[model samples]
Target: MKARTRTNLWFQLALVLTLGTLMAWGPAVPVQAQDVVVKVGNIIPLSGPSASVGLQGKQAREMAVEEINAAGGIQSLGGAKLVMLYADSESKPEKGVAEAERLINTEKVHVLTGCWNSAVTYPVTAVAERYGIPFIVPVSVADKITEQGFKNVFRIAAKDSWWTRDQFAFLKDLQEEFGTKVSKLAFVYENGDWGKGFAEQWKKLAAEQGYEVVLDEPYPSTATDLSPVVQKIRRARPDVLMLVSNAADAILLTNTLAEYKVNLKAVITSGGGHADPSFLKAAGENARYLFDIVEWETDINKPGAQEANAKYKAKYGQNLTGEAVDAYLAMYVLADALERAGSLDPAKIREALAATNYRSGPGMIVGYDAVEFDETGQNEHASLVMVQINDLGQGLERITVWPKGARRAGYTPVFPMPAR
Candidate 1:
């Protein structure tokens, strides 16, 4: 053989050996690549009146997805990664319905969450139930949403009556501790389902607790002027003001109260406007001493609650809403179900979720001892906390006050709120 022919033979032998080695070792594929994708959809007010609450929820859900994906995705289902989708409900019931249908039909999401406002939640939930999609509500407090007996719908937050029950206990404790009895209450709530649902229960509960309902005023959720209603409350001379309005109305009512220099023993603001960041900003100094019953709080002593909040604030430039915290927890709840399911089938995931007993890891981050769904698809173990806005050294902090489980409460409740 000539030298060129010998060289060609050597090159061909090297190529053969390299091919054999490549075949034996396999291709250079990543060791951690996910084999499947679990798609979930979130429907909240990304725009319009209630966007403040919705925006926080949106960030929280996104953060949860990011955290879950970072933790090597789901262990079962061949390391399937979670994919998030969003639909803006615009804070309207009809819009919520439209967006939910779009997400289900177009986006092909496996499970759904949100539609924050109770008015929106009611209609949106109906749509999800109609389509056989599992819908987990993180924020809406309307009891009838779950009372309608839909298995596909689930709620992680306390029901409307739960807040009222907690309120009664708080009042009882306040009277015992401070001798400032709230015998008379003036109700000012919007006309929506949340406002109406809470007010209806509040009226019955307040009366049974010996609280005289002085003036039950129902205003439009979009009402910009609450002066007339404040005038009614002031004249009624109620010991406590019961507020069940949205963020905009909450801001308006608080500002109007301050402007009129109305004084009361205390003000009980249901979560809507009372806990909203916009209510804090818009109500200004008037927000101080305003007692709010909330589902979640940053000051909770849960292991990772504050750290999770810090990460949230770093990105969002504000504190997270109680609803937002719940939304974050919702993702983990779904992820837990997906992991146990070990399959992408919606029915299997629903079954796994129904059997969820998530007490650790990302699922219990909301401070609930255990997250187990009841027959009605509501988290029976879910509860709420009471937070009061106080002038802390840093600024206005909504410190948890009523619930003894709260990690930090600055002082005894401030009885007979000072005049503006």
Candidate 2:
């Protein structure tokens, strides 16, 4: 009985000391909350043909993540810091799949993003879905990525259907505005999911618009020599050439077309390679008067666009392309969702993302107003803008022209492009 009394007395003293410490500190902070880290896995092509755009995406994500962390991180979860893990897909579907599995099962990443090539993203989405991890696609414009009915897939860019629709609309508007009739249309594109999806829509749109299809050509983007393709384009003798190409191929096709002097009324391009900064330097005069559709341009008149572009240019030594802008905005979107989620659970984060209606922030530099997603995980507010590559005394810059309302002030588009 005496030994039991002594043990009870010691326990009482220890409890009193613990209460005293708690009172001194006012309240106890949960160590888990204060030290929580959100791990994000990113899979992008760091090498291979698409490396330029992939590097841009990586740089953009780094910049945004730095800004987010510096601004006190996710406030909702006791200031949890976001941790990023990167995997290079090498622009291969198999590589993307392996990386996704490793990131999900081994790296234990809470969320996943990327595999910029639609072909790569397509297979990686299945890996992510199998594991139930949230997959965020910034710029893979394939419509079927979201059409898979997977709950965890969310895309931030306009799908191929939307892009194709806008391209046709711009074409029609150009003809109407300048009183120049465009009848024969040639479709030349890379033979990939993205290009084929676009070509399919282009065919239907061409038929609906009552334009004759002069040439339908699908070439591999990796083709080193495009003289043969240019010859085919020249032989087709189409009034307008509608092209979908990647960076190297875009430069190749542009220069080759110039070398062969394949004169046409206009050259409308999908933004993938044509909007790349290197396209301007490599294609030079050849890329002039080319109209490309994109999500954002350096000259956009949005609130924070100039500042953001200035910062990105200062850091990366180049301007941001439509693909890079989506990546930059994506980081901001993830941060916003994390703040609302207040938990590291992927489901919570996905729910917050689905409910996201991000309108204003540093990342609102996009051409659109908001970043709200539709039921199918597609950003409904996302839209495309057409920009003409011309020298406005600024030494050949991309100037917004289509959608008339979004066109730059005091500038007129040169229709029926001048001959070289």
Candidate 3:
């Protein structure tokens, strides 16, 4: 009887052990999937004066996200999908801050991008830094945005100083080519961060270059008529006219110039004015003979650039705007950083981004190698290109690259200065 009882006890113990082992490593039980979603945020002006440009950026970003996801997602992170959330800042700084807060606190995005205007971008970047999110600035040109010394913020586009420097270099080349002195210059800009920042840079550079700035005018962004400003420029009668306005105001100024027949030897604009295709459509023939300093070219379809351009055209059913190109490049940069990091952790992504030095989509070779941050988190070596809007209103033709002596010399001027 004792032997039999011992045998039963052993059998019960073995059965319990077997059941526990099965429960611990059972085929019926499911394993949880790894977290494979990267959240990115965007703050852009979707329903404001700069909406035309902002919309293009928003579309480009969405397209890039879709493409990246379609290609088996992010391969470096076990095929993780990129999720994007966007907020319309309405081109207002205050609204940008609020949206940025929402994106950070509520949405809990890992990275932040977008904001077309410098005014909106400037404030939104601050919020991004406050929350320790990596912010990639695509289109804002204010020097201070990068100069603020935030380690988490990176801008792919040129600053205001760079733009002015490029513009001055182009002007010098034009002066040498035409044998005409660009001594007396007139400056007209909107009364905003972009306008003020660029205008100040131009003024300082003009002084350094020994060019005489005859007249300087700052108009309201909401100004209905630019006739008074046009008249002021006409009266100044400077050798060259430099306009710094957003697309809508740019249209207004151009229309005024055409209607009033303000004949000047040369009309040049900073990037914002004539960079968008809407400028050509709005100004029509008036846009002829106007020169603009731009960051990207519609032509010169380099390998990757051509592919991006084709994709943009296919998706939008029209040519991609400059802002769109920047947005696309921004996504490409983020993707490269994520791949290099091999993880989605914000700190790791930031480290990888600082080490990024790859060719962007097209028209850009990012110098992310040693992207050491100044106190303001701005990349010190950012550059700009000088693009001349041709009479045909197609892609901006490359006239000069920034940092003196880097221009394509002896190219025939597509939009030459009117006979003086």
Best candidate (score: lDDT): 2
Q: If ranked by TM-score, best first, what sequence of candidates would result?
A: 2, 1, 3
Q: Write the per-residue lDDT of candidate 2 for residues 1-420, one digit (tens) a residue.
A: 999999999999999999999877743545366678889999999999999888999999988899999998899988888888999999999999999999999998989999789999999988988888888999997779999888888899888789888889889899889999999999999999879988999999999989999999999999999999999999999999999999999999999999998899999999889978689999988889999998877788777788888998999899887788898899999999999988777888999999999999988877777899888899997878899999877687889886675577787898898876
Question: What residue runs in model 1 are displaced by over 4 Å at the alpha carbon?
Answer: 1-33, 47-52, 90-107, 117-120, 173-199, 210-265, 271-288, 363-369, 407-412, 415-420
| RMSD after CA superposition, every candidate | 10.7, 7.4, 9.2
Off by over 4 Å in 3: 1-35, 46-52, 88-102, 117-120, 173-199, 213-239, 244-266, 271-287, 295-297, 360-375, 379-385, 389-411, 414-420
* lDDT of residue 200 for candidate 1: 90
List of clashing residue pairs for candidate 1:
none
Candidate 2 displacement at residue 350 in angstroms: 1.0
Looking at model 3, residue 261 earns an lDDT score of 75
Candidate 2 yields a Cα-based lDDT of 0.89
Q: Tens digit of lDDT per residue, candidate 1, span 33-114?
A: 4556887888899999998899899899989989998897888866778888888888888888998999999988889899
User: What's each prediction's clash count?
Assistant: 0, 0, 6
Kindly give the stretch of ten consecutive residues in candidate 2 with the minimal lDDT sum: 26-35
Q: lDDT scores for all predictions? A: 0.82, 0.89, 0.75
Evaluate model 1: give its lDDT: 0.82
Give the Å shift of residue 15 in candidate 3: 33
- Number of the top-ranking candidate, with TM-score as the measure: 2
Where is model 3 poorest over a 10-residue stretch in terms of lDDT?
365-374
